[model samples]
Target: MSSSPQPEAELAKLRFTLEAANAAMWDIDLVANTVVWSENAEQVLGLRPGALSTTFVAEPEWIHPEDRAGTLTALWEAARGGETYVIEHRIVTADGETRWVTARGGAVLDDDGSPARVVGVLVDITDRQLLAERLRGELAAKDRFLTTIGHELRTPLTAILGFSAELHDRLSDEELAPVRDIAQIITQQADQMVALIDDLLVAGRDADSPVPIDPHQVELCGTVRRVIDGWPDEHRGSVSIDEGPVRAFADPIRLRQIVRNLIDNAIRYGGPTITVRCWETPIEGRSHLVVIDDGPGIPSTPPEPDTGVHPTGIGLAVSRRLAERMGGSLSYEHVDGTTRFELELPLEA
Candidate 1:
């Protein structure tokens, strides 16, 4: 038979184990008005274990000023009630570094059910707390970016649309044609800019607003035809939309913008013939809308611009942003000397 451990031997063993563990251990004797802490406590709190001899009460001064009173009050209540106490708080080390820690304890009761002692464990949670704070900051930044872009784009777009409409209404037949062309170009460019701004906003907001989209049921073919019809015949080049209408549940306006931007970019950078195809395929229980184009093809790397804007690259970026917002993705592939742009939006059932 194994012999039972004496009280002193058992306590000594516990002290040894606590000293070896990473966590800090503390014990307070209520009646004796004294306190003892393991060596690890000094490392955790930046205080020598034996430096404070009067009482453990002053040790709470190391806690963050904002949390010290509340923590002490809670612990006192738990001790008075002969119950367990658990709390997490911030403390300042001797070097003045703030660290997060979780402390848990239970009251040790006398034979008469009166509280005589309190024992507790303290663990550093600084790393986990910092990570959580960083994530919150990132989310707030994204929200701010979306709101700012929306406000900025609306101002310029309103002016362009209003002036173009007024010019179209005021010009005479002889004077109208040239003025009309100018107004139309202004309107088209303004619309494109607004669409790009919206896409950027969408990308920033997507995490919070993921909506189910159905690409198979959306009238994609008609949307493409309409966009092409809006372009002048000279700049229109060879445009083709497959015979069948493909349906998708993506925001109709955003989808149209994606198609228009791609086709516009192809005409601006590629040869006259621009082919647009829309189709749906199921992938892992979701549907996708794919738009391909045969353009001069995106450069292996983005070009270094010396002066003017590179509309093709800008348009592709906008399209990708929109696709991501609609719970989808956009990608490019070059095959057989043709550059293909694919926009994939999740299908809404």
Candidate 2:
């Protein structure tokens, strides 16, 4: 009959299994300050596989200086306090290459119930750590590039707005009626362009909320009419509004911004006609503004900007944020083949 497999053979089989997993096993003697390693452990520790004592005199030196104290403390806690630990840290190889390693270990108790030894496994995680660092570096570089581009765009934009405002003022003084209309158009378009740049910079910030809004009691009908009238002459006839002196607690600037963005989107993306409506839901007693268009519906787009991007949904996102900052909410619904957007605000008492 074949003899039962010896413990030594079983141990060798276990070590082979560990080697197959790309892991190295270690057994540390608490009393002798020495360690026994699986055959493959030396390569994992960045050491040449050679005959050496069970003691690892240079092992502490291999650990990163910043991590050495913490590593020793963790080992002591596991060996003395019967705790288990998993640590990821850097180790210097024989050739001075830094590698990240993850170690998981527990202590074995002696017959007297005192800590006798610690056994552990080590794995190289250098590739994973390196990949994480690379991604973070790439993200940081992208943010810096966006900030620089925003600043560059703002320089020429500031000059354009200033000159347009000056020309608009001068045209009012002269009786050049035809050129006055053109000057007014340039000033209006310039103002809208500045709002777009402001939206870009504000929305691109790395923060939970980017819009800074101050809420006040705003008369709604006049504001809404003025905004609708400001639209291009061609699209003005396409929009209809319900005339009422409805009041809302909202930031005036943000309110106009939100209105313009919504109107702009409807004209750009909607079907033939659009309607603006408002009413107060007195159940909980609140005022809400509604804008509906015969558009297909609001569609989700890729978050990243593409070249030659339009202002349709781009400004819509920041409009929602500005509404929220003023203690209001912006919501969208598509019903009966019409796309509807509503801005709900607290009623100013």
Candidate 3:
């Protein structure tokens, strides 16, 4: 076996390995206010690779103008306090093209404990930035499509519901039972369609520009009362509430959504029995708004196609997200002959 390699030989091997990985090395002389770069450094700086001295000629000219201030600040901090840092920024290439790179380095202190030099490596990351930008564009396009579809659907649905309501008013309940029933069905289904469209539009909204959640102490009983009262006549009587002065700290809009979604899901999927109850859980210092229905409980495995009931879909998932966003939690359990969904939230202090 060959003798152990010398320290100088090992350092040379490390430099070679870095260059092979497309990483350029940088060394800054703090006292001289000058920088020395490896041959590959020019490549990362957007300059022809042969020029070793091109880096310090004018550092800002090599960096993207928008990134120069932040980059210089990082470089200065490393030199001043011997701080190690990693920064990702764009560089302007000689061809006027912009490329992303990440630089990692720290100050090298002298014998007197002063910064003698700063050293680091730079690696290209343009591909990652391009992929992120592409994903954002695709998401924005999807949001616009949802908004356009909502506008298109609501226009015709409003007209159908209005005309059906007028006709229902004109005919006596005893005159044509079939025709009266048809008009009532049309109105109810159209209203449901409108609500579904609204929820779809809400889902596609820009998360960065979300309507701010405005949380405050709110009375759950009154909100439930209004929501139940607004349900279609046939479905309204099935829902019963025994909530009294139940209070929680929550965003009103989000609370309304969570309650409305639970109520609607119960009516559509819950077999025949449903109830809304609210009470304070003193042990947890929380308020529980519970919706109980006699539907088959959530399955151990998702339901198969054409089964008795499909699993809860996007609508309920969104409601769960909203509840969590407001410093609250939602849970589900199957009690004797009933499926219970409880929305647990903060009690007003």
Q: Name the top lDDT candidate.
A: 3
- Arranged by TM-score with the best first, the candidates are 3, 1, 2
Q: lDDT tens string, model 2, 317-337?
A: 787777777777899888898
User: Which model is ahead, 1 or 2, in terms of lDDT?
Assistant: 2
* Every candidate's CA RMSD: 10.5, 7.9, 4.7
Model 3 RMSD, rounded to 1 decimal: 4.7
Error of 3 at 250 (Å): 5.1
Tens digits of per-residue lDDT for model 3 on 1-349?
8899999898799778867777788887877867777666776566866645633554567788999889988988887997898999998888999999899999999999998999998998898899888878887777777778989999999999899888877778586878987897898789878777766666555565343478888888777888767567667888888856888888887788788888888887686777889988767878889999998766566644653233555567666667777778888888787989999888864
Candidate 3 lDDT at 287 equals: 86
Worst 10 residues of 2 by lDDT: 304-313
lDDT of 1 at 236: 60
Off by over 4 Å in 1: 1-38, 42-142, 169-172, 202-217, 226-229, 235-237, 282-290, 302-312
> By how many angstroms RMSD does model 2 differ from the true structure?
7.9
Candidate 2, residue 153: Cα displacement in angstroms equals: 1.2
Each prediction's number of clashing residue pairs: 12, 0, 0
Give the alpha-carbon lDDT of every model. 0.72, 0.78, 0.79
